[model samples]
Target: MSNQWQPHAAELAEGLSLIELSDGLGHLDLGDSEDVMVMGVCDDSRHAMPGYAMLCLPRSEGKATQFAESAKEQGAIAIISVGVSVDTDLPHLHLESIAEAGLLLRRMFKTEQASTHFYGITGTDGKTSVAWMLREALARYQSAPIWSSGTLGWMRSSNNICDIGNTTPSLLTMHAMLNAACQEGVHAVVSEISSHGIAQGRIAGLNFKTAIWTNMGHDHLQDHGGYEPYLATKAGFISDCAAHGGSVVANADHADIRERAPESTNWYGHGLDRDDVNLGWEQELPGLLRLSCAGEEVVIEDIPIGDFHAENVACVALTLMVSMGIELQALPELLTGITAPPGRMQDVAAGYGQVFIDYAHTPEALERCLKAARKLVRNRLIVVFGCGGERDREKRPQMGGIAAEFADAVWITSDNPRGELPAVIASEIEAGMAQPYRVELHLQLDREQAIAEAVEVLAEGDILVIAGKGHEAYMEVCGRRMPWSDAEVAERYLHRKHPGSGFDGERLCA
Candidate 1:
């Protein structure tokens, strides 16, 4: 949870033998000196210390041997890896698969026995929004503090936020977070579960009290091997919750999800009957939201902007009604306090022109965001976005095409580009568009400069949307993470352009 870590496990105070450490999770035999005792467990070589059992994780890059060497030199008592020992000096243990280690990790951290309720939201979209909404609604309903972990990292409340390192962190890292959350008096936890996390068994022994599957679309196609695998991965988590006697809530609008969900799964979406959970907006944005549950409806005057928000609200409402024993009629008061997770269609002051920041990298999410943003303005719509490197390359062109189709002006720039050339990524995105000369299109690799130019060209009533890195504060280039923020950068330019006018999102300094 914290940036700095001193990895230690108190269960091994007197030290546990290597055989006992492995249990059924590890497979390695050292006939002699098999009783070597390990005081703690750590996977990071830099954090390894005397009497610690180190885990050798697979990496896309870097030498694995060097990591083991560093840990051994630091006095690691043994090494647990995905496969058989890899020429290591320390006593070694291996697993049949990476997921098997989840059991070992759960026992090591003791989170499997914790009473804190876990709620998971998985899918290509709406995970972050749904998780935060659940957290906010639960915090208002419960007496204990609520903690959530997702794209924006871990945060117990508005004033308390910490880095979680990933959308779904590693098994070890997640255990550490849950352990910390339990220690901090948190009785409920809401988190986003990614496909990679599910495939890798990050949620191993943590039985979710309820899980929601938002709609899914084109995303991480390569990582999951294809559409079916990706769907299966996401559905696998939902099914896991259902199989474990936990509640399951799915978006009925998504046919794939509706068809795949368990028979007992509770559904909520656009056009359901009054008997089921549903949402109806009497008016557009800044209008009344009619949330119906079991033929009962509540009218909320102020609502979050976006068509998807209705579904998100309905999903949360259904979860509370079915799983948490809160009546649908009581939701009107608690629902008012629900807040949107930051960086999703967030509005900021831009003087004459309005600027919105959203983390819409996929085609569907981007289109939805642009449509919502377009409704907010009377003039031209300008957009700035770029695809992340080393990810699903197929979505890059689709995103570019979506931007061209929706925006009057498009600024193509760099986003992350972990190991790929920024220019190459931009060119691929540009390839999706036709008849736009390289010069005719505004292509800028420097993200800040791209945002500056986009902000400068904003007209009196035009709305500028900086998509793909919403609340993200860092840009990963090569192997390093550099400081960056879409909203902060846009705000600075807006402030500079109109020094006298308060340029905060609300247009008021306070």
Candidate 2:
């Protein structure tokens, strides 16, 4: 067995023949035999398989054991774990970081096939909405395009969708997806860029033509360690776009984004009035918006409800104009017929009034949702919302304060309270309320029942805003996902009460 290593690559055994191999023990390399194929690389060894190379990273003993067990079933060729072992007869090499192996693979395959336009969007909120909306709009005018990596992660130009867990996939998967899209003659690729993805170098070496900056707020503090780190990660996306002389559309309304604007002729500012340039929503209506930009008015009617959605549409619209060269005058006509993204201020027809299911988990997003719900109705605005467990707990009570201020009736219910007591999370949120109001402290822990109860109590001319799990089709609890949908539950209850009404917003049961 021959042992050779590369310092720069941080990979073990450059080219060696595996004379002997074991699923539990490492590999023994002969002087020849360079045809070993690696099936997949994972940090957890439990997923390791037989007939494949298993690279177990140091400080990941659990992963190494997992790999050893799973590899036995899959018929793995060799197991490469962290640190050095001299007692074993198997050939072994040391590695500094397992992530380095993934990078090495991409470097060896460094070559471009075709010119692809990539649009990357990053922010605390609006990342998914902007990415999805841009892809949908671009399809109407351009040729068949392929977009991957966001909520669902992988969606082809053919609209074949699959679940890839990360907001930004691994470097290997991302490049592979991009390569596939290029081979299919895809015109563009739209993606949601997360802060963790940027910091971890997941998007390294990828060529992006356009980038959009949404407002930055307090979220993901645990991952980034602080607000400054979070902001820096987001700024990196714009910097990458600027390096290629690509257009970067920034939110002028966000002071942080405006302050961190990069130097590029393609850079365009979209905001409300500043230094003789004002770009934003002219008049925002319920599910409609009059978007004005660059002295042109594009009234986008029947859009997703929410005050902040108007701003999101503005960013997407301006991005189209600056990056794809879509005409501004033709935008209103184009966007007027667009459909709202799922779970984002989605209006569910109830028997008594309209019910809105939104993914407004943050304080700012909740505030915008409440304010928008207030305008769309004649009588009162009722909100049913709760914070998720094991997340940013500080925002719990703050959201409670917003509910107290904006909502006519507030129902604090469990929202994916994973591994945490529902009562504890509700108590934290209740601490922030300033005024006395009709608050239903339901520790039901069942989201469907909460929505059903809220719908049953709604009167005429009232709106029930179900905030938290917007487009998600399932509820996650105790590391397990359960089938659940707020919209489905509300619609089902509404239909049973009002026969033949059939999903209309105006029909009332009582």
Candidate topping TM-score = 1
lDDT of 2 by residue, 234-321 (tens): 9977887888777787776677877786855233343334343335564435667665555666677777666677777777777878
User: What range of 10 consecutive residues in model 1 has the weakest lDDT sum?
Assistant: 4-13
Query: TM-scores of the models, in the given order?
Result: 0.88, 0.81
| Clash count, predicted structure 2 | 16
Tens-place lDDT digits, model 1, residues 141-236? 996689888887777786676666678876676676677777776878898999988987766667788888888998989998988999999999
Q: After superposition, how far is residue 265 of candidate 1 from its true place, in Å?
A: 1.3
Compute the lDDT for candidate 1.
0.77
Candidate 1 colliding pairs? 349-505
Cα lDDT of candidate 2 equals 0.67
